[model samples]
Structure formats: structure tokens, C-alpha cells
Target: MTSFRQSDRLRNVRYDVRGPILTEAMRLEAEGHDVLRLNLGNMHPFGLEARPEIVDAVAAGLAPAQAYSDSRGIPEAREAVAEHYRRCGIDDVSADDVFLGNGVSELITLTLQALVNPGDEILVPAPDYPTWTGAVNLTGGVPVHYLADEANGWNPSIEDIESKVTPRTRALVMINPNNPTGAVYSEETVRGIADIARRHDLILLSDEIYEELVFGDARHHHAARTAGDDVLCLTFGGLSKAYRVCGYRAGWVVATGPLHRAADLLEGVTLLSNMRVCPNVSGQYAIPVALGAGAPGSPLPADIVDPDGSLERRLALTADALNAIPGVTCVPPRGALYCFPRIDREMFGVADDEAFVLDLLHTEHILVTHGTGFNWPEPDHFRIVCLPDEHVLTRAVASIGDYLARRRR
Candidate 1:
């Protein structure tokens, strides 16, 4: 019998957040060991529950969900997404400019599919969520990684991004409040990136999924607002991170700025959206109530996780704990539920981060993602999800410290 093989297109696609190391962690758990999973930023396992309003609203709309919604999404959900962005300062958006999907994951693939042709270049940040890289490759485009300088608070180096642009470059993907590195882009940084996009005539793809999860003084500018009025920008965000409803698969993409120029691209996106028939209908039902919370001055449940008041207490404590380990220094994440810490390779004499991660898992029973897994060129860093409880984070990092000490021997 012949074994089934994956397509050649999947060769460059990688999502190491749940890749090999996670598979090993699962194997250990099945053998009956209690593994502390810090590999993924999943909220529910850490005690977050779906809010009452979101649940009730979806339940109330369950009847209509039996039928397919409009290909772009039911009008109510699209309007809610549009209104959310409008409040964020992207005033040009309307229901027609918004497209709903199961999650930002689907929208990202669709957006890339519509825009990229074979060999087209897409400038993306280093140390990014692998999905962005995977999407570009799957769409037959090349992902050109531009360094996001760690020394500069993990902000994208404008010089690096600009230097990589070629005539074939079609777009720039910005993951604000970045995944592996939680550095939120300051206002100046956001504008600088937008200026590059405008000068090069590149479509701006902004992933703002973690926009609502900022910590400390880390400022995040809405990419749509910062991209200027003449640039075409698609900003993607969803209920996964903000509302702690990753399982609900409710997410959206909003077109903004001078998007009218890309009439053909937007139509391509719509046709693809229709190819899927519609996103999860049940997921579509929860949008209005979830987003109905009034404008800027009005408080919404999303604000609870913002820095200083909500998860700040845990984030602050976790950052301190990780940095306390000798030769392990982590920039306290300004936003998002992750800590990407640099490991002094000379201190441990381990050159492969993936091996280091697996050794830590086997010895400490704590799972983490390696930096190379997120496409870091060096083996000097690893990503740890900070979504666990205060005590869990404490124990997990302490285990890592002990494991590091052993590696030093």
C-alpha cells in the first residue's frame, strides 16, 4: 500500500505553535503525565469562560442559523464589524467593506489568495505567527521576512522593510502587538510602516487580533487609521483573543483607507467568500451583541483584559519571574498573552532551540514553542504563552529555571 503524501504547496507552510513539540507534549500526557501546556495562548483552559451576553445572544439567534447567511456574512454582523472599526478611527468602513469568517485564519488565507500571484513578494515581520507565512506560500507568493529588531522593542525596522521591497512586492503584512514578541507598535512606528506601504504602493495587511490585549504603556495604533487615506488596507481582528471565545470561530476583516482603488481585488475576495457559502452561521449570530457595546467613551467587556487593571497583574508578575532566571532575559510583553525570552546560547551551550524546548518539556513537563518555530533565524529564543494562572506561570517558569540550570552543567 502507498502512503498518502501532502501537496508540494504545503512544503513551506509551518505552524510550530502546535507543531512537533506540542505533539510530544500530547504523547507524554497520554502516557499519564500531567503536562503544563504553555505552548498555545488558549484562554478557556486557564479559567476564562464565555461571557453571558455572547452566549445568550447567540442562543436567541439560533433559529435563523439553520440557513446560510449572505456570502459576506449576515448584514448585522458585517455592520457590527464595520462599526467597531469606525470607532477605532477607520471611519470609511461600512457593512459592505467588512467580510466575516470563521476566524482571522480564514480571512487571511482568502485575502492572500485574492491578492497574490506566483512569485509575488509579501514583506512580513520576523518572529511572526506562522500562519501569515503559510498563507502567502499557499497562495503561491513569496514571504520576505523583514527583521523586527529585538533591541527596538521588537518593532519592525523600517530600514529592513524598505530595503527588501522589489517591483514584485505586492503587500506588507503587519502583526500589531505581534505574536511571538508582544511589542506593541508605538504611534511613530506605525506611521513609519504606513509611509513605506504608501511609497511602494503595497497593499497593507494588518493583523490586529491582539489589539485589545495591550499591557503597560505599549501603545497600539489601528493600522487602518495609521495607513493614511490613500493606501489600501485590510485590518483583521476577531472574538478569539478579545472575547476569549476562540472556539466560537467568530472573526472579520474590514477594508479601509483608499480601498476604492482595488475594485478588482475586493471583488476577488467576495467571490472567494461566496465559494465558502458563508462562515459558521452560529458564530455569525453573536456579533451584534458582542460588538453592540457603545463607542469609544463607553466601556465594554473587552476593556477588562487591558493592561494595568485586568490581566496586567498576572502579566507583570510573569515577566518578572522569567527575567529573574540567569542568562534568560525577556522583555516584559507590552501586549498579548505571551513572553518571547532570549536564551544566552553560550551559557547553556545548546545551539538548537527546538531541542532545548523538548529537553525542557521532558525534564520539566512544561511545553513551550521555540523561536525558530516562529521563523527566527537564530536559536536563541523561545515563546511561552502567558495565559496560565499566576500560580501556574510561576511553577512553569520556575521549572524552566531549574532545567536551564541543569543545562548549564
Candidate 2:
């Protein structure tokens, strides 16, 4: 008898956010152990939910959404995306430039499938969202990592990115208010990356899914705007993070900057989109309402989450707590919903981060993703989501500190 195996394309692919650690966590749950999941940035599980108006819009469109929409997206939703970007200062966008999908995750896979051939290289940030690296591998493309300098608040090192470019490099990926690390790229950093892409003549793949989730003085700079009318850019945005609608799976990728040159690639994306028929239709209905002229000042559930300060307060508490630990230091997250904290490998006796996290699961009953799982080349860090309330977050971090103290002893 022959063993059934997954396709060769899946050989190098790994989405560790839901991989083995999650499996073990599930096993523990089956044994009736209560687990604190600080790993995923999923909002609803932590009592963060979509705005009522957005939910109402989805419900109202359910009847019309029973049928499949145009492969690209519902016209209103596509136009809403285009208009949203136009207001963001990418003035040339129109509905024709937008391609909607079932969240930015799907768009990432689709864009890579259309762009990469075997052996092509794509510049992905070290400590990326992981899905980007996995999707590139699934497409048989080589993912070249450029360091996001932790010494400089985890901004992408422009020099490192420049040194990694080669003739085979096809595209450059930028994640603002980045996941895992939660460092929003500065305007200079964003433009420097766009300049490198321009010089190399590479397509720019900007993931702005957390665009609206910035904290403090942090502001998101659109890569497409920086890529300008010269470099071809695919700007990916979605309702998942900012709108607390992860389950809706609504996202859009806007093509800008010399679109006339990339007609062939866009055609491939359209072909792939058609193969999937369409994204969730009812979710599409929320887009126009979420981004249209009359959209709420802020899409977050302020009423439920302490009048807009809840996320900021939680992230601040988590970072502060982590920094207070003896052998740990967390670069305060300026945006997004996580804190990527670095631990002293020597002090903690940590050789393998995965093993360290597994031990944490067993001893502390808390689940956080190891840094290496996000494709960081080091075993000294781990990411914890900051969506939990103040009390829960403080307790979880305290548990982590207690666990680390034991490791030192």
C-alpha cells in the first residue's frame, strides 16, 4: 500500500501560527485544562467585535449575496476600496484597479501564484506575518529575508534590503504596523523600500491590513503612493484587523503605478480569482459601508472596549509588563496588536524556541508563538497578542515572568 501525501508544492510551506503548538494546546484543552491563548490576534475571542452598523450592512445584503458576485468583487465594494485609497492620497485609483478576495491572506497567495515561477526570489521581512513566507514557498519561490532592525524599533534595515536584491528578485513585501513585531514603518523607511523596488524594477507588494490600527503618533504610509507612478505596486488591505471582522474574510488588493506595464500579471490574478468564483458575498456588502463616505469615524468597537483606549491600554500594559521581567525586554509596539519580546537565551537556558514555548504551554498553561515560527532567524523571542483585557493581559504576562524566573533558577 502506498501512503497518501500532500502535494510537492506544499513541501516547504508552514503556517506555524496554527501549527504544532496549537495542536498541543488543543490536546491540553481536551484534558480539561484551562489555557490562556495569547498567540493569535483574533479579536472576537477576546471580546472585540465588529461595529454594529457593519454587522447590520452584512445582514441586509444576505439575500442579494446568495448568488456569486463578479470574480474581481462586487462593484460597490471594489469602488469603495478604490475611493478609500484615493482619500489616503493615492489619487489615481479607480474601481478597475481593485481585486477583492477572502481576506489579505487569500490575496497574498493569489498574488504570489500569479507572480512567482520556480526559483524566483521575493524579499520578505524577517519576523513577517508567516503567511507571506509560506505562500511564497507554496509558489516555489525563494523568500529572501531582510532584517527589521530591532535596535531601531524593528524598522526594516534599508541597507540589508539593498544588499539582498538580485536579478531573480521579483517583488518586495512591506507590512506596516507589522504583525508579530507590531512596528509601523516610518515614512522614510517605507519610501526607502519603495526606492529600492524602483531601482531594481521589482513589483511592490504592500500589506496594509493593519493600516488603521496604529497607536500613538504612528501613521501608516501607503507604499503605492510612495511607489508612485513608476513602480508597479499591489497594495493589500482588509477589514480583518481594524474592523474586527476577521471571520468575514473581506479584503482588497489595489494595483497602482504603471499598470499598463503589468497587464499580463494582473490577467493571471484575474484568472486565479475566477477559479475561486468569488469571495464571501455577504462580507462584500460590509466593504461599501465600512469605507464609504458615511463610514464611522473609527470602525473599532469603542463602546464595548472603553471608548477607543482599550487596545492602546492593553498593548501598553503588555509591553510594560514584559519589559519589567528580569531577562526580557520588549520594544514597545507602536501599532498593531502584539508584542514581540526578546528573552535572554543564556539566562533562560533556551536553546530551541519551539521547545521553550512548549515548556511554557505545559508549565504556565499559556500559549504564545515562538519568534522562529515567524521566520526570525533567532530562537530568543516570542510573540503574544495584546487583545485580552487589562486584567487578563497583566495576569498572563505575570505568569510568563514567573515561568522565566523558574527557568533561571
Tens digit of per-residue lDDT, candidate 2, span 358-379: 9999999999999999999999
Instruction: Tell me the TM-score of each prediction against the true structure.
Output: 0.96, 0.97
> Given candidate 1, what's the lDDT at residue 8?
95
Candidate topping lDDT = 2
Q: Go through the candidates in order and give the clash count of each.
A: 0, 0
Task: Return the lDDT, model 1, position 177.
Answer: 83
The whole-model lDDT of each prediction reads 0.87, 0.91
Clashes of 2: 0
Any runs in candidate 2 off by more than 4 Å, and if so which?
294-307
Error at 53, model 2, angstroms: 0.7
Candidate 1 per-residue lDDT, tens place, 47-139, comes to: 776667788878887898999999999898898888888777778688999999999999999999999999999998888888999999998
lDDT of 1: 0.87
